[model samples]
Target chain A: MSAPLVIIAVAIAVAFVLALWSRAHKRMDLEQWAVAGRGFGALFVFLLLAGEIYTTFTFLGGSGWAYGTGGPAAYILAYGAVAYVLSYFLLPPIWRYAKARNLLSQPDFFTAQFDSRLLGALVAIVGVIALVPYLQSQMTGLGLIVQMASYGRLPEAWAIAIAMLVLALYVTLSGVHGTAWTAVLKDLAILAVVVAVGILLPARVGGLHAMFTSIAHLRPGFLQLGAKGMGVPWFISTVALTGLGFYMWPHAFGAVYTAKNERVFRRNATFLPLYQLILLFVFFAGFAAILIVPGLKNSNLALLAAVEHVFPAWAVGVIGGAGVLTAMVPGSLMLMTAGTLVAENLYRPLRPNAGAGEVQTVARVVVWLVAAVTFLFSIHSNAAIVALLLMGYNFVTQFFPSVFLCVWRRAWVTLPGAACGILVGVLLVAYFALTDHTIVAGLNSGFIALAANFVVTLLVSAATRSWDMRRTALRAADIPVHRAGEYDA
Target chain B: MSIRALALIPVLCIFVGVVFANRTYPIVLGMPFLFFYMVVCIVFTSLVMAIVYACDPANRKEE
Candidate 1:
């Protein structure tokens, strides 16, 4: 076999082995499938959250943004660190609440807290919409990696189809456990590749200092944010919007639910920033790429292009394997989250009498369904990875106000008020995104919409004085129940 | 102030103050000032969180 073929085969084999291994010593149930029975300790939760956060977007898209846009890409680094700080305070209470109530998903939190199945269904709908693009972008990145790694010998579409199939099968079988096991391998591969390429490429073209000097010479505003483009205001606003919105992703919230305890969740939050330091190396790789390989049409290919230029075929294969996992691990988790949202929150609530077996059956079916849809969508996708991420973030961030308020304990934000606020916030986000209009100077359009959401939520809550909802929320917060076994089918 | 509240001071500073260190002057360890500043904020965040965890009542209860 050729060099690319050898590399691709080795990487795929490792990923398959990891996936199959994750299913070992685990029972098949909704609790096991959805949230891993809420038994994950700090280290497992840390790796799982790391896997969920640093997707193909971080590997390909982070480098891609650094290569394509230059300074604005700094926002990528800023947001994760800020989100970690937020999570320190945000997650423990949530874990406490979730573990107490046996809440399996983000929508379950909303449903039980507000006593509104409609609210739960609404969250499910919005979450599915937000997550599909995220899922598709990973497919897009995987397609690019496979096609590029194979020296264009393999078609992008076929690569995506195979990845989608593999992702769906593992997710249907092992759920979060499978994603976590693959993550351990994926994270190791990514850290090694990112550090090696980050240092190697820069040294090849002189040194880190020399590479930046040359990039500064070629592209004057490349190393720092310029007054003319992506100014301080834009950077600050984007970081803030993204930071606040970070854990609002339903899949991320689901990961938080998997933590063994409040203390474990808190510790993971405290330590996650260390994991984020890996992106700096990724940025270095992108900075190196601009000088080493120029005139690439798709900026997303910057890392691959640089690797191909600098590394041997064998090393490139290793990085390619890592790259494929970066996409697949997160892609499978997304399929699981979106699938659970549809079956558990959307259908189960409506049916009201569905057995656990029936619910699990629906979830498995939906997993395949989601993968197929994302597969078809990504085949025709033209959006860049960074653009897809930001677009998804814009919509998902609208949930921040409602979720934060729900967790804060003192806030009496009513169910109807939350419903209205979410509708308005989502509409504003859609309108601004569709029009490509800058509603406020120096700020992300999403931030403006989020502010509007908070204001609307506060006003509606105060006006109606939702005393009954307040009582419901307070009661919901206090349910410190022991972990219950799986609901009988 | 309590340790929990104190921990947020640096986080507020990083988000509101240090983020504007956007200028490329005084590059430290091959990173721009803004980049260096962000890294500091991240490290600072970890430290503060460590402090909060140390002081947390939950830890005390376990002990």
Candidate 2:
């Protein structure tokens, strides 16, 4: 067998073993299946969190940006590091609330906190919309990885279909425990294979200084934070959008609730920035690409080209396999998180008596449905790395103002305000994305929309004082839960 | 699980960067030296994670 296929087969085998070992059968139990029985210690929490952060995009796309856009790609570093810090400040109280109320999903927190299922439904709807594209991005990357690594033996369509089906099966069969356990191996595999191969590339090439001067001479503006025509406007817009939007992702917030302690959340936030070394590496890959592989029609393949060049066949196969795994685990997590919102927040509420078995059955159905629809949607996409990222970040941040106000400020807003906030936010993003009118010189859409959302929500909320959901949530936070061992560890 | 483990990712990134920064190639696949260095960083990231797991106390518990 070719090295890529062999490496993949081994990874698949490891997934199977881990699924069986982590108690796939027992995962049908609500807590065990959905949230790993809420018993992850510091280590499991760390890995699970890391697995969620690391993705195929981080591998392929980050490099693409660094290569194509040069130093501006470092915006990823600025945002990622900022996100961890924000998540730290934003996540702890969320944990205290969720553990107290036995909440599993983001919508669960909203509905329970505000006693309004409509708000829950609104967040769920936005979440499903945002997450579907994310999962598709994962599958799309997986498809590319397979086709490239196999030297086109596996076509993109067949690769995506088969890889996604396996993801669906494992998620359906094993649930959260399976995701968490498989994540450990998947993440570790990526970390190991990428590092080993990364080191070998520069040695084969002339060396670091040679790579730098070539890029500097070829495009003098590339290394400058702002190209002359572009200047600070583009960089500021990107940083502003991503900095606020990253924490608003549902899977990330779900992790907040999964933390064993407030300190764990803080530790995770503080420490998470340090894992961003790969962003720097990815940025470097782009610079290195400037020298050796001067022009490829598709810049997305920079990392793959690097692998094929620097490593032997077997090692190349392993790296290729690792890239696909990077896609799969994140794809599974996105699929699972999307499904959880549908089943727990939507279906379970409408049918309160649905048994654990019924819930499992519904979650399974939702996964396949999301996968199928997303596969269709991703068919025509050729968004640049920065563009796809900007789209995802802006779309998810629509929920933030509503979420933050409901939890923290005791300022209950009107349904009109919430509705308008989402509507205005979507319209602004759409106008910017579709019309190319987003050129405010130094401002991004998220900053504009966030400012508008806060303004509208505040005005409408002040107008309708009695619907104030904040005080009610505040009253609810003081109610204590029965303590179990390692509760808030 | 120590800060040292996390710290290694940046240290190694800088090291890989120094290597790529020192390269003489003009443009590989339409990307710059910085771009080329990114893939190397990811591999560096993966390697650090793998060794970290092997040493992790809790990984043994799971096994």
Candidate 3:
């Protein structure tokens, strides 16, 4: 067996053991399985929050964009910094609300706050649909990493199947506990691998400055956004849209439920942006690849190709092992969130008599089912990793206005209004995707959809208020009038 | 001014500053001008959030 494949195998074994070990002697319940019983402190919460930043997407897609799209790739860095800034204000109220109501899933927040099971179910459906492509992207990234690292000895399909089986095993066995524990190891490995490759690869071409200069010299416009489609307007709109949408993903939104207190989020918001600097190294690795391994057909392979060009077989094995962890940790979290959303929001509402134990069982079963479905899609899919993630973001971002209103002190939006707004936003996103018109007049179609959603929500709520007030008055009049100071108690 | 409003600094830097910084010439710290600008914005985001954390009465509350 190749050294890299052997190393990857050992890494997977160790991660699996660590994941199972996290559940040692602990009882598993619906609450424990979903949000680690809402007891994680700042450090674990930080890891979970930062988990969004360093997925297989960052390891592969971030670099791939830098290698392929050049200047537009900086949008990844810009959006993340802005997101962290927003999270400072956004997450605390959410954490407080979730804790007070014991909400375990993202849809639980909507259901409880809006007082509508139908809205909750609609959200759960949208969350799962958005998550499928994201989960598929991670699985596809894992397959590509393993195949490349194994020197083609392990086919992409087999790699995805094996990794997914391991993911399902750990997630079902230990739940969110497994995802958090494995994230610690994944963070360390990714940090070391990214820094090493970012610095070492550039040295081969006379350092970072020389690397950029050579690329710029060869391709003058390579380091800047394109003139027509991906110009300044596209960059601004994408950055704004995605920054607002970053925490809307079901996994990211549900992660707030794991925190012990609101302070965990406040602390995380402060430090997470520093962690965003790591993407610079990811971009560095991609830029170095442009100099060393130019003209790669599938630019997603840029990071791996660059590593293979310079590093020895054993080093490649180490990088591959880290890459595998990057995929598995995030993939497991996504699976866990998708399963919980299905069980709690979708299934439980339909069968209101179901017990917590039964619901937990269903969630566990759904984890395996989701893993299998995404694995199939990952193998057959050819969409870019970043593009898939963006599509997911578009769908989930539609939840922003509803979520914002739910958290406000006043109930600014009625249930019907919230429902209609999300439905309109989601439908518009679908239309944009089907028509291949993501950029409308230099603005991201998702941003445009969000604007339309906001307008519709307010207009509907205003129109419904007077009608609702009159109905309440009529119902009040129909009731028997109470005597003034009845009984004088 | 409310300390919470300081958060807008990073937002504006990223969304607005990038327009002016999108150039290959005038490399700063061995990186393209745009990339360097992003790095600066990231560091500044941490600093701004830290200041807000220090000033906010919410964080001062006892756990």
DockQ for every model, please.
Answer: 0.56, 0.06, 0.79
Candidate 2 to native Cα RMSD, angstroms:
9.1
Question: lDDT of model 1 at residue A341?
Answer: 92
Off by over 4 Å in 1: A24-53, A173-179, A227-229, A409-411, A437-440, A466-489, B56-58
Q: Which is superior by lDDT, 2 or 3?
A: 3
Better of 1 and 3 by TM-score: 3
Worst-scoring 10-residue span by lDDT in model 2 chain A: A480-489
Interface RMSD of 3: 1.0
TM-score against truth, every candidate: 0.88, 0.77, 0.89
Evaluated on the second chain alone, the candidates' TM-scores are 0.81, 0.56, 0.93
After superposition, the stretches of candidate 2 with alpha carbons farther than 4 Å from their true spots are: A24-53, A227-231, A412-415, A434-442, A466-489, B1-63
Best by DockQ: 3
Model 3 backbone overlap count: 0
Per-residue lDDT, model 2, residue A217, is 81
State residue A127's C-alpha deviation in candidate 2, in Å. Answer: 0.6
Report the error of model 1 at residue A214, Å: 1.2
lDDT of 1 by residue, A89-174 (tens): 88888888888998988888887777677888888888987888888888888887778766888887897887787678767666
Q: Determine which window of 10 residues in candidate 3 chain A has minimal summed lDDT.
A: A480-489
What CAPRI class is candidate 2? incorrect
